[model samples]
Target: MHRVLDILATEDGDVSEVVNRFRDIENTALRTAFHNCAVLLRMLEAQAGLTPTWEGGPGAETQQAVASNTKSTDSSPPTKNAPKRRFTPQELQPFVDETQRGKVSVAKVYVDGASRGNPGPAGIGVALFTMDGKKIAQISRAIGTTTNNAAEYTALIEALKLAKDLGIQQLYVLSDSQLMVNQMTGRYKVKHPQIAEFVAQAQELAKQFAKVSFHFIERENNRLADALSTAPIAKIPNQRTDSSSQELMALLDDNPDEGRTE
Candidate 1:
């Protein structure tokens, strides 16, 4: 099931190819695993308001059942909604002040992560700069879905990898996700099973740096990374290409110091 989820998360390769690749396994176990994963994927798709059509095949009936379950789950939500709470400006002032204090920095490296349909298409974005406000590097790549935090850590890991590749010894990493920053800095506990491995990978990479520090930043300040993270995937041939081109140009322009030779 995990293998199927991994493949589905990538959203690459032909579905038939995937099924064929798993054909070596015993039929009963394979069908069980595939159906289980398909069920979960159908649920995720439903949450994203996508209706999947399964053409008649070995697992077609099971897929239909999963889709039906998804529809029922969607229709059953919230007979009566829970009340919402609002925070007053005065009450939020202290936290705002703390955030402002946290933003005090000459240079900031902003990183962000994005996932399409939550556990579906995922990507990571990173932007780095100097203390004097010189733009350094901006990078974004599609990484397939797992989770938001996984993508976040992957972004940070990629940033660190790039920094090391560029011979950067000292850096101040900044991200909008406090959980990620705090966990990396050993200030917070990493209890989530999904993120533990990624956190360990980040920690392992950190050891190679001469000096590395992490700080949390407001989402507004981290807009470049956020934009890159949320940028839509380009569809080839039939669709318009200009939008993705512009986004790529903007990302490139945001950081001029990329690949600079010391």
Candidate 2:
């Protein structure tokens, strides 16, 4: 809404035409806002030009219809296909430039995990953000049935693997799960035998990086990764426990800690 107001206030030439174009919007509140802003714009123009009355040309009837409909208290919901204002050519380039900022070499990785019913269906989400905080890559996938903490470790493991694939030497990792962060940092021990294997795999992958750090972040600040973690079951390919996760676990279990103790 604020963006629309800025467009109306700054756009040059045929402001009334632009105002009329938005009059067909089905949302009463939005249509009314456009109408009122148009009126104020005309009033300001009249004062500047020292005119007797503001000129609202041929589209004046459409404006009146918009105004009249705005008064209707009918509780019908707004139409889903309501007209939306498009960004002008001037606005497109900046958006593109902003999005491209994440294509750099170093990135911050955010990971999250979600489970439907503890050991029920589960998924993990990983996002890579460039130094300037633009997301360059995102991964969300169903990892079959798993416990919540196991899913969290899966997210971390996936993130580390992605960072390795990207050849990212430095990673600033963040997750909403404090337990996962602590386990990765070795502040907490991995007691679950199965989870310990996954944790060991993640630690091995993290070794590939020249430098990597993990931090516990608040859930609100991790919205993108969190949203991806809960992707619909239909959208993700279902995998069995005997597949990738287990394969990686087995590979790590063979070594049992790179010929050392944890």
Candidate 3:
């Protein structure tokens, strides 16, 4: 720590010294490990509202450019209580050293749920990714008859289960279910009894992780997981566990397009 600080404090925080020090780490995997640790440290600091005080810290130029772009685009009158601005990729670049962007251990998961009817056949999907946006693993499974919100929570639960199985400690989850996200974040009340129960289950599962974050993305942005969810339900003959064929599916799946339980 002292050596790193000394390097950063030198020559008005000239990062060339830091680069040179990094180069001294001859082992490639060790270099990536160090870089990943630093990334997590910086995230923890940011969570505590701490910012780098060192002069000429990493990505200062890009950070300024991003900020400038942000200010330039706020020309329109701001709406009242405009939902907290989504943090774009551009805004998060300053935290990562460009050289080590793809090597960081922080991971992300995109999840989605689908139901033909609110209480009709349902499915959950999950797609986990590495820090650099590489898809690592995915899941698409049907979970019988359930409410849409329950399916949403089931998707989250399945994602968490996969992440935990993969030994992931830091996770960022994205879902197209706005109701699920808002309720998980305590922004909305869990009104339905079934949904409330699932919410508790999800929250308890989240506690097993070192960190878990949930965000709401539009359905279009969540195509992969959305497709995964739809697949298990869309193929009725094969996806069904019983000998029930297309005709039985038709009977159970009537008005499957309706009964959207939020």
Candidate 4:
């Protein structure tokens, strides 16, 4: 600690000098200690909401020019890294149109899971509808800390359970998450052990229904479910699950996915 402080105080916070000093240290234990100290300092800086500055070397000018060019292009198409635009809940609806030949008695279920920080406070949302497009039930619940994938699986599981309780025999499951949909349909393998457990649970619940089909939809087609899954109630400390669920259910029921296909 003292050595790092000394280096900062004497070297005017020159990270390069500290880097050089650590590079010169031959003792493995001392080097490890320095590494830990550096990591701690970085974590502290992050906690303080500090914008880290880097001393960009020779390519700094080139990088800046590229950035300026990207910013200057007014009519250019979006880059691969552009932020995705979300659809309003009103815009989401079943992919199948009313004009479709036959409307089976299967219940349509749209499920979504949201995580603020991927592994942060998470929530699951499920919207159910009868074959003729009558909204029947909705379920949303905050599941505390979990990954998006976990929340996605949880949403499906809860939806399956709800369908079972409703005595639903046929279910058409829909999700915006291609990964979750693919995994459920056996198109993709569940590589993670935790995800495998969730999949197994969902499978067991699915057995209650005579037939359950998984389908992948685009984000725009899943607005209602997405909105419920990412609702603000999930972030409240000591939040009431029932209240959150009710709020989400209301939102889902009122904001029926409608309009023309994108």
Candidate 5:
């Protein structure tokens, strides 16, 4: 509602057209807002050199019909105290426009994992960059205390997941973890049982793509991924000081696979 108000206040060539556009909103409180704020919007319109239509403005009859059907007794304006309405798939199409994402079938994924200690607080960062070097999205969050190796594999898993979400087919995964890169590329054997599981999980996700290649990147070149992985550490207290707090902090991000320990 606030965003709509801001848009109405904008000096468009035909501000009334903008006002008429939203009048068809079926949401009671939303439509009510447009009706109650009728005078204010007209004043705004006139202030910008546009003619003000206060009495029986465009869509006034529709607003009157909606207002009479409203069941709420309270006359107070709506507040954003309730959960936001979820958008239907059709409503999401506008956001999928070129401004949000271009035709991106190939992308470079940079992933890095950070841990305060060998088996302390961990976080993973995955940055998706298009072939033209445009960074489209990022994933950054603190994971509960876990080994550095587990976090590295988790980062790769996340990178693949993000790629799949974006419908990316060809992926060039760049990481600063040499051991992880070597293992994923078949240069080194996975001796650690736990890490082997991580490699297995990553391989399964990798199969979803047309091509997924791992490459060793210099730590200097992987600054964005490094920063993303470690960014959560400072936001949460050290595990040694408050393990409970760290656990709570980890809950802030939505994790689909919960209770999966490292």
Candidate 6:
């Protein structure tokens, strides 16, 4: 009934024309269902402060007369707070045209994870870019305490969530964590019970898109996301920090591999 109401709300046709469209259905059961639907529609119209009168010119007058003779007055009115305005067909026609003509665009994403110690202070970073290399968004957040792999999984989850928000149909995920990429792509089995839930969440998010691919890259090629991952550690004042800036600098300067290629 609501679907019929929504259709009628957007169309400019008279009620009789609407009824005739339903009446042409060859199935007796479907015709009976449409008849009941039409009755419910008339009652709804009356409740919306409109008098139920057919407007299909002189031919519809007889149909309206027969309907009026059989109709009852037990119908309830619309609630006082019911919304008044509805979208017209003209307003939504452009959306229909665009849907039929437009093609889905793909988005590329980069993700990196960081931890001060193996299972210590951690942060996750994600970078979103268009197919043409234009950066769309970057996000970095500190997770209280977790392993490097957990942080990596968290970053992938965050990136997928952002892609969903952007309505991206295709995604290419690049990450420096081979373990994360392998596990997400089903090449490696998740052995740790602690990180299993996070991996499951990432897999669920991947299903929301039409297509997604994960790639592993050396840390050198993932510099932007790596820099974002370490930004928070660099912001601490020397006086209040446990470690000096030089030590932090050395940690950032250390390469995951000395002779790795992009």
Q: Estimate the lDDT of model 1.
A: 0.56
The model with the greatest lDDT is 5
lDDT by residue for model 5 (1-262), tens: 2453443443222233443455448888877777779778666644433322121222223443454466565542121112233333332121122443535666777888987754678988787765545557777778887767788889999889888878777778988777788788887767667778999999999999877888875564566677778777756766464466644544421132322322
What's the C-alpha lDDT at position 82 in model 5?
25
Q: How badly does each model clash, as a count of residue pairs? A: 0, 0, 1, 1, 0, 0
Q: Candidate 4: which stretches are off by over 4 Å? A: 1-105, 232-262
RMSD of 2: 19.2
Task: Provide TM-scores for the models.
Answer: 0.48, 0.51, 0.54, 0.51, 0.54, 0.51
Q: Which tens-of-lDDT digit does each residue in 1-262 have in candidate 1?
A: 3344343332221243354355546778767877799789878856754333221121223434555455344542221121223323332221112222223222345688875544446777776554434445667667854456667888898888766655555566878777787678776666656567888888888798766778775564465676656553322122333456544543442232432332
Candidate 6 lDDT over 134-203, as tens digits, reads 4566776677555577778888999898878777777789887876776777766665665679889998
Tell me which of candidates 3 and 6 scores higher on TM-score: 3
Better of 1 and 3 by lDDT: 3
Candidate models: Cα lDDT each:
0.56, 0.60, 0.61, 0.62, 0.64, 0.59
- Please give the distance, in angstroms, between residue 123's alpha carbon in candidate 6 and its true position after superposition: 1.0
By TM-score, is 1 or 5 better? 5
* Model 6 misplaced regions, further than 4 Å: 1-104, 236-262
lDDT of 4 by residue, 1-262 (tens): 3354452433222243454466668988898988999789767645433312221111222333354455443432222223444645453332323332233335677899886655557888887765434556777668887667778889999888777776676777888777777777776666567778998999988888767888776565566688778764444665334455545543332222211122
Instruction: For residue 197, give model 5's deviation from the true position in Å.
Output: 1.1
